[model samples]
Target: MSSEVWFTVLVLLVGVERLAELVVSKRNAAWSFERGGVETGLGHFPAMVVLHTGLLVGALAEVWLLRPEPPSVLAWSMLALVVASQALRWWCIATLGPRWNTRVIVVPGLAPVAAGPYRWLSHPNYVAVVVEGVALPLVGGAWFTAIVFTLLNAALLRVRIRVENQALAGLAA
Candidate 1:
């Protein structure tokens, strides 16, 4: 009935979606490994997991603790961004297919995919990540979580993108 309750429901839904992604990612990772896929960037994987989990937890914590009542207009706009980010994220997954595991695993001798959202952006999923990092929390008026997640995610993405580029380069070679 309340906006906070709705926000909690939304966050729980997102968490469920993330679990579904993990299921797909695990299956895809297995597919890649079977195909001689080489995984890089293991080092940051733990940090990424923690930070992402923190994003959800922190949003809830901040909202319940701080109790900021974001205006309806702002909340609606941020919700739109969150939905858009999810769409883009799923687009990336579909385009990459079995190649879309969360880890940076690249199969040798395969060509780089330039289709779907990848046609325009080298890391479109990261675009979704960045947007959602900020927007999701703000939807709950969790500004602190939004700012902290954005900053931390930026640092993590810097390492992630570099590792991914190198892995992709191996495919090219």
Candidate 2:
């Protein structure tokens, strides 16, 4: 199989990984909500879902239809970034543990995490997200997909980070 085919498979695997995360997220969300967690940013949740799903679809579509040539150097670099992004995302999840839900469900009276990546960055998970959003598409030579997703993700993260900060306001302080 060609790299293109492998890239498509990787994209599909990412979709599956997301579905699995949702399962964990749902359980965590329930646990948090049970402990009087208040969720903010309900409005953007659906848009996030759509945008993430569209990323996979757009990546595949671009690869299948356009077949852009992925330069070896760029492809490897992007692929490394993708792997690093996944590592960072998992680190964020593990660091947060049950407090890490896909939604912004904050259980008040509890402290915000400030270790690991959180020690260095306010929103380290978003760093992973941004890198993956751009790198994943580029792995398949989907420049258009990368560009569009990066722009939209940027817009979404602006709202998301603000909402998250509000939700966790004073916890880390």
Candidate 3:
């Protein structure tokens, strides 16, 4: 199969994975909401959805429109990084369990989760997002998409992190 075809297949697979994550996140959010959890960082949620959607659209556009032929070594390396990022992303999800909704809702008296990826980095899922944002686009020679999304995500995360920290503090107090 051509790289373009392979890239399309990869995109479809990613979409399915993301759909599954959304399902899980919805259930987690419901659980948290039932326990009187307060969601913070609402502002970032819509932007995140747009950014993720853009990643898919931008990647396909690059492959089908620009058709840039990246070096095979670089393409394969990026493909590996994308796969690795997915692994880490899911690891963060599994580690957080029901506490891992897409929204930042803090359950009172639960004690901030410190297991798995949380042991080292405070926000390992964001790390996964950063890696995958760049790696996925690079696999398809979508440099513009990668750069744009990375910068946008950085800006969004600055506010998101503050919101999350404030929510956690409220829970602590």
Candidate 4:
């Protein structure tokens, strides 16, 4: 198959995967709401959505516009990193279980989750995110997309982590 066809297939697969994540996050959000958990990051949700959407759009534009021909070795390496990041991301979700809503909802008196990837990094999911943000775009030789999204994500995560930490603190106290 042509690279264009491969790119289309990859994009479709990512879209489907993101849809699945939304479904899971929505269900988890409902569960948290039923349990009287408080969500603290409502204000950032829209920005987060926009940023993620931009990442996809920018990646596609880069692939078609700049059309940098990457070495096969680099392409395959980046592709492997993308897959690994997904695995790590799902591991985070599975470990967190119902507590893993996309929203920052805290249930008081539950020890902050420390299982799975969280055992090492305080934000393993972010690690996967950082990796995937760069890897996905680079798979199509979209260096600009990777760099832009990485910078945006870093800024966004700074605010997100602060908000989430404050919320979790309320539960811890």
Can you give the TM-score per candidate against the true fold? Answer: 0.99, 0.96, 0.96, 0.95
Order the numbered candidates by TM-score, best leading: 1, 2, 3, 4
Report every candidate's CA lDDT: 0.95, 0.92, 0.89, 0.86
* Candidate 2 whole-model C-alpha lDDT, 0 to 1: 0.92
**Clash-forming residue pairs, model 2:** none
In model 2, the runs with Cα more than 4 Å from the true position are 170-173
Q: So what's the TM-score on candidate 4?
A: 0.95
Backbone clashes, each candidate: 0, 0, 0, 0
Single out the weakest 10-residue window by summed lDDT for candidate 3: 164-173
Model 1 residue pairs with clashes: none
Output the number of the lDDT-best candidate.
1
Better of 1 and 2 by lDDT: 1
Superposed by TM-score, candidate 2 places the C-alpha of residue 1 at a distance from the truth, in angstroms, of 0.9
Highest TM-score against the true fold, candidate: 1
| Stretches of candidate 4 exceeding 4 Å from the true structure | none
| Candidate 1 Cα lDDT to native | 0.95
Give the Å shift of residue 12 in candidate 1: 0.4
